[model samples]
Target: MTRRPEQFSLNLRPGNLRSRDPDARAARDFAARDFMDGGGAPALETGRTRLLVAGMVFALAFIVIGWRLVDIAAFSPGGEPRIAATPPAPAFESGRADIVDRNGVVLATSLPTASLYANPRQVRDPAGAAARLVRALPDLSRTEIRAKLSTDRGFIWLKRNLTPREQYRVNRLGIPGLYFEREERRFYPHGRLTAHSIGFTDVDNKGLAGVERSFDAVLRGRAEPLTLSLDLRVQHVLARELAAAMTEFAAIGAAGLVMDAATGEVLAMVSLPDFDPNRPGTAAPEARFNRASLGLYEMGSVFKIFTVAMALDEGVVTLDDGYDASKPIRIARFTINDFHAKNRWLSVPEIFMYSSNIGAARMAMDTGTAVQQAFLGRLGLTRPADIELAEVGRPMVPSPWREINTVTIAYGHGLAVSPVQMASAVVAVVNGGEFRPATLIKHAEGERPAGTRIMSRDTSLKMRRLLRLVVRRGTGRQADAEGYRVGGKTGTADKLIGGRYARDARIASFAAAFPINDPRYVIFVMVDEPKGIARTHGYATGGWVAAPIVRRVVERIGPILGVEPVRDGAHEDGGEELLVRAKARASKVATN
Candidate 1:
């Protein structure tokens, strides 16, 4: 019942409503009759009406023919089009989220990029296209490009992760077969500075090392950056000092670690001979080795700190206990001697200060092997460090628990551990005997986690005093950062090369804590195969080479960490007179 009297629209039709010929012819009959017969046109419109009608019919037929031809061309009875230029769906959009240091400094991030692909079948001239592409991207192999273009595959990758300029140049070439698909390139803002910590990604942006590999799941499709406990400023300082020490001592490699003694959070970790994460593919294997956490070594006398702590904790030894270090002990084929041997009997503090290997071995013998191994296991040294890095070294302990093994391990030989392990163990020694699992993530302020107590609080306090005493008058004297109350041990051991210990090759290391009275940080540094230098008086020992590096690090980082210099303070036992005497003696020795 609906009325259909309205004019229909016609586009380019011969007899449309707007056509002059149609209007004139249709209204002529009415026009001649007069104004009484409704609206009309002028009367002279004659044969034009028939001509317009015929023309409209012919035009409609032509349109139908043209439409049919296009349909046949599109649907092709032969098969699908060979030159179909539809590109593959992208693998990632926006890519993985950013990675940042604890201070919100960007370490690793993603950048929008263009990748070129080719439809070989569509390439009219493979050789010419390949040549043009080579001109645009000289690094690309010309033979590979030509071979890929000649394939006749539906699609193939020509180049990946192209720069904006490169993409523009290639696009300007306007080769028919070439196409660009949007992608993202993984980038490191600091490049090699955080290479071992932030790690690098593959062409697909999948993490392969360091924190990037450990937290890949958290990063994928995540908008928020994954924040780590590392401070870039601290990392820079650590790296710079380690690099300088490596060059100064002519070391093959070096490692350094700075840890929060209270919270177990790693502030900074540096491994020399590091690679640029952005160009990891071209770096040497040695350069890629992460010495701080991934490489384990017999860390020499640094282990003495643990041995002494365990002895004091188990009541096997006391601060006043004395041991004879006048001569080396001959056990089996091994001779245990001290680098700085004291001719007479030495108290526990003197033995620690002088780094007497014989005294440390004797202390371990008294503590017993079973108890020593158990204590080390408790410190997480027998196993891999519980840090976030995927690359971690497993400690090398003796296969059979023997008496000699115990003694050698007491002075940090026979058993090899990573720098991180030594640093963490030292943290426990100074942090009121609490065993905190080292972490790469930050903990909230005043939200300290209760850790397992490995040693008595009384024993920890005594150990702190002994460490301070060593730094004050012992082999660790060079490690003293004035007013910082530096306290730690200097460890020197021969590197085992081939099948036997290499006497010429040694690992010199220093493990230290600052403001020993109220411990806040634990630092460890190791220089591998450092050749003796003239400035060090031809000594490759820890005290001479590694200790100074630790001193510099402490001095540089103290103010930044809000730890001001407290030059004057009495010992726990209130030995003000003895403290003044030691300072006077140190000043005299420095002047001499």
Candidate 2:
């Protein structure tokens, strides 16, 4: 069998048997011929087989990538399925109520802002990320930023109150682990103009001062905007005029308030050197102090209004009563002398017009301590004002109610009350003897609260006439508004420091009511530690310093508040007639 190989049969296993088909036979014959010709077999070479397989694999990969592109661009439309699309992160969970003026002008608001934060664990290159962040936020130190990023804390605030430019620059960095938290930041568009009344909020979106603190819970949860009684136009006028006065007098501090006498709503309250609520940390302590409601001072002769009103209300004196002011009265160790003394027997009208301390003391004696205390209590002077603000001051009244205390309080000394308290009391006397609680929030239509009656209607009318006469002919002559018939009393109290009154330190205040016939507005101005200027004739009295401020404020705000000026004779049927009759009777009695 081995002699002829081609014809011989070879034993083979089942897996090694060759096929007998024509195609297989032809392939085997061709392969044998090629091998005999010293050429490689047609089936495949070592490297070529690998090359062909790799080419097929590359084509398949291209087809797959193209299909995926089409699927992403056109096939799938609603949202990405392969990779989930992230949702926008929420900003502040708690929303704040809008603050608008009486005229619906936006005073304070919360605006959407992007604040930078970081997830320390997710940051790859903390040092590099911090450097880029610092470049974007100049206020942030590189070391501090790096330390915050490297910390173990899961989250940390990197920067707040970023500008749009800053946000864009930070986003461009594309640093890993850096993120933005949308937040609502409180903003005051009017800046320091309404600082005292509107107040400001803290970093946690909580109210910390002013009306913001008073109605915080109401503002945060409610959807309705908080409408305030403040009129932006009137507020601007008051602030502008007060700032001018503060600069002109070189005064250490200044305060002014405008209120609706009929409604007891504060229109504007200004305390000088006021800071923007948007940046409260930079404000001085004096600026944060609400002088209208927190700073109590013995408001000098303005107390004369209370004294005279009490005397009339108690029936201890009449408009026809006369007092002997022939000499300064010596009571115990205190001597009562008028700033401009009229050393003679003066009628009650004369006494008020001249601002005689002696005359005021005698009037208080007639009213008696019990009656005086009762009158003040009824007028809401013995307690803090019932307003929404947290910075109200309780009136400092003598505990013992001594004889000297009563006499001194009569002339605006030995008693301490806030300017707001004084203004509210004055409003009671002029607003038909009703004491309405002052309010910062706007009341609903037809929802007026009934006020307490503190004085008789007759006493109110009589006091209105007297207050008008004081502005027209007395030391408050500077407070006269040309057509408004502004009437008020001037007070100059020596400020108490370290338990003793400082002769050089003074708190000059003016309390005035406009359209004195039917009083509609009450304006109060106070200047603390005012220096006598050469232009002011070197006098720091309330009449010279604070009275002029009230005059300007009234002239500017009266028009804005819709208070039209009328001729003095127009009020003849109201309180002017009563004033004339009362003055005539006093003169006749004095002559007798």
TM-score of each: 0.76, 0.78
Best model number under TM-score: 2
**Global CA lDDT of candidate 2, please?**
0.84
**Global lDDT of each model?**
0.86, 0.84
Query: Which lDDT tens digits does candidate 2 get at residues 1-592?
Result: 2322332222133432475656545555655665667755443575688898998899899999999989878887757477777898964454898889988998888887899999999998999998888887788999999999999989999998787789999999999888899887888899899988889999887999998899899888876679998888988888888788888888888888888887888888888878878899999888888888888888889999989988988888888676888788788888888788877777777788788999999999888999899998888888888878999998898999988988999988988988788888888989889999888877765576788998799988888878877787778899987667788999899988999889889988899998787888998889988889998789998999999988898888787777888855763433344446556765676688
CA displacement after TM-score superposition, residue 461 of candidate 2 (Å): 1.3
Candidate 1: C-alpha RMSD after superposition = 14.6
Best by lDDT: 1
Which parts of model 1 are misplaced by more than 4 Å? 1-93, 117-159, 165-178, 567-592
